[model samples]
Target: MKKLLTAILIFISLFFFAQSRPEIGGNFIKSLFTDHNAEKAHTYFDSFVGSQISVNDLKELYPQIQGQMGNFKSILEVNNEKDTYYFYSDFEKSKLDIQITFNAENKIIGFYFIPHKTFDKADDKTALKIKSDDIELKGTLLQPTQGDQKKLVIFVHGSGPQDRDETIGENKPFKDIAEYLLKNGISSYRYDKRTYSNPETFNNQSTVEQETIIDAVNVAKYFKANESFKGYQIIILGHSQGAYVMPKIAEKAQVSKYIFMAGNARPLQEILIDQFEYIHKIEPSKISVEDIQNIKKQVEFLNSKKFSLDSPTSELPMGLSATYWKYLLDYKPLEAVKSIKTPMLFVQGGRDYQVTEKDFNLWKNQLKSNKSAEFKLYPSLNHLFIKGSGTPSPKDYEGKGNVDEIFLKDLVQFILK
Candidate 1:
């Protein structure tokens, strides 16, 4: 999942448009994704598109989406809200919602593609209950029904309120990874993130150490104390934000190995700035100078020593409290990893836009001398470890794809070693 800066970009857009025009907008979107022909779709944008974008640009963008979401299926639903029309369309691989804003003349003025969330049916057989203090968390454990488990891997989620499956749009990358590990004779556990299960428990005062780290430590302890897992080695597979804090968890828990997937070594506030700058550079037409300035102001507030839990959250990015940012700023993943002695595997996606190749290199440069640390980089993979072509946009995460099989193979070897 992306951090504050990226989430802000996802939810907000500027448009110089008027009332909804579903018929025109819907057909226009269909023509772009369904026909996968830029030349044919150009007519729809002729009068609407400004000098900032051209027909050839629209053509290139549409075909790139086809590469990610396959062919479009049909429009599932449509809603007219405010001055915009929202069309939810089914694609061969995933469901995507397109929002189109029109000018007073019924010409399209703005367009956006958003991933639609899909909930999976509950599986009772894999369900497990975990108790952390007064709170009980529902989780799932995946393992071969008839085989002895060689190792147990506990999945730690990235930022956000994630379910046990870490479901993103139509893809459940964690579930895919667990199933693959189970087939290879490994057992894995994943639970609904604390924030997802108990939102009321978290407030502006809550820090990552309190909200995330403590619960992860408890989960590890719970498994280590279980009689069923007595003979198996314990592994902590931390992804993104989870990976950033794995070393801290290792300090408090008894885990054999740590797998960092799309993890970052730099401070989160710094990474957030990097993400904003990168996106602004890539999509200059979409990102306004005012937007960039606003983000910079937020970054300045985050870096200020006077910032505290009581600071106004309205000015902060991602609607998170100053306390949360303070905690992240205080923690240094690279320094934490330096002190950790446990065997480590850092897995990175070369095409990941959120946590880019720069983070992976930081890890390598910091831990290269450590004999127990290893690294793997997949050039085509994104933050979720799903393979895709070209530069990975957030839309690519909506596509139906599994965690790369090659990563699973490597993970199996790491476990056995």
Candidate 2:
């Protein structure tokens, strides 16, 4: 829950690539009506992509998407820190809303086809509701049936304000993980992120410090003390941004091993820059020189501790705060990882959107500093550790896919041993 968590509207899954051709007089641009120019949507977003037109140019030739998508739709937003253009399409009373993110130059980084059901609106039957930390967080706990002295695993989700199941598309990833682990005689706890759980409570507020890793830390401690978890070793499995917080949680929990799931290996600033640079390439044509310059200034301003509180950067996107940026910049997980001699297992999804190969490599580099680090990457897996490639999308889960069997097997073996 970044400072302004309540402002966003979530939906949709379709993604697209921008720019049909190389440059100025490309045949694709000349014939914009053709399907060849329109192109089939891509599943994953690529950074360093060139655009037919950069997103900045859109202000010059803007056609509001609001009439079609509804109010509160953003024509441009951030991906890793670069401004990307997004289009929303809500059709015929269907619950699904399609939101596509673009680069500052206006190329498509990816799309989120948000499923219709919101957490508040979702039926309770779909979730195993629980309360913790004096906040009524929604989540499901998996119990190992007929098992004695069961160890505990806690599930933590990434950057977004996500529900307990870590729901995306038609999939509830945490629920899937919980059920699978339970079937294998392991007990697990999964909970909705505070960002999503109590967005209104934090309405119009939150810089980076307001949300992020600390919630997961609190959640871990809450369950570890539960009567049901009386005699178990608490192991944490933090995926994506959750991974960013895992080491901290492990430090606080003083528990067993930790599962690093799709965590950011680089500093938050570096990752954000990389994400933006990637989008810059795709829509090179759509961007204006002035806009790029402004973005650069903004990123630099964001990274600066000397930045003024009154700066315009504070109002961007989710209103990401300077304090939050400072905190993230100051957060060094490896030091925490190094500090703890706890046994560690690393899980990397090969086709993740935000976490790239470089990120995993960085993790490897840092963790190797600790000889006790255990690492495994599933080449076919996406950010969620479910399998996919070419552009991982939520649809991957809706039709068919399983979290890598080996990842789970190895995890279970590690815990059991």
Per-residue lDDT over 154-186 for candidate 2, one digit per residue giving the tens place of the 0 to 100 score: 887878777777765445667777777787788
Off by over 4 Å in 1: 1-123, 284-286
Query: lDDT tens digits, residues 1-417, model 1?
Result: 469877776554323133237777876876777666666556555363755577678778966777777777889887665677768788777776787776666767788885432222355677787898768877888877777556999999998877777778787888898988888888998988888777789988898886778888999999899998887889999999999898899999868999999988887767777777777778765566777788778878877876777788877876788888778877877888888788999999988989988889999999989999999999989889998997667668665788999988998899878
Winner by TM-score:
1
TM-score of each: 0.72, 0.65
lDDT of each: 0.80, 0.59
Task: Itemize residue pairs with steric clashes in candidate 1.
Answer: none
Q: What is the C-alpha RMSD of each candidate to the true structure, in Å?
A: 12.6, 15.0
Clashes of 1: 0
lDDT of 2 at 243: 84
lDDT of 2 at 37: 31
Runs of candidate 2 exceeding 4 Å displacement: 1-134, 203-210, 280-295, 308-318, 391-401
